[model samples]
Target: MGMMFPTSLIGLSFDRFWKLKCLSSMGFQSLTSLEYLWIKSCPSLTSFPEGGLPSLLLHLSIEGCQKLEKVCKRDKGKEWSKFANIPCVEINGKFIYDPDSHSD
Candidate 1:
């Protein structure tokens, strides 16, 4: 696990990370109970943790992370498969994936 992520946690918030760069994929996948992940203002972040996110993750939000935002290009993202099962996902204040919002 990196400095911010630990194992078997319920949820975590990544806020205004001015110096954070990258994360290993293995660490976050071990978070069995992790349901929500919030990332904000990490300008230098170019990618998600390498492999994938935890299976139990239900919500994901990304804000002010331009580089990472480009990588997570909606369904075309490099890590799109990792996000497929997630019920909700947001990027730059927009909902990339939200099952409930399609009620129109």
Candidate 2:
């Protein structure tokens, strides 16, 4: 088997699990079944893969990533627009883009 498990992982909740700090890379390439992702205080993480996350991912939480600029951007094409409408991603305890907020 691979370093982790198979592709089907629904309702998976990861909270403050400090072990992630040592992991050089997190391979979720085939986690097509993942629905919810919760990550916090991973100070060493720089970025996720460049193709965006699984289409089934509903809720995503990322915090304390002081070095992260863009979460996931398409390597080619106009795929950046695909993420323009998704509403389930939460970054730094706020919605990805809030019209009323000046921080964006």
The best candidate by lDDT is: 1
Pairs that clash in candidate 2:
none
Off by over 4 Å in 2: 12-26, 69-85, 102-104
Candidate 1: give its CA RMSD in angstroms. 3.8
lDDT of 2 by residue, 30-76 (tens): 77897777767766555554566567878877776544424333222
Per-residue lDDT tens digits for candidate 1, residues 57-90, read 8889989988887777756877667677788888
Worst 10 residues of 1 by lDDT: 95-104
Residue 49 of model 1 has an lDDT of 68
- TM-score of each prediction: 0.79, 0.63
lDDT of 2: 0.55
TM-score of 1: 0.79
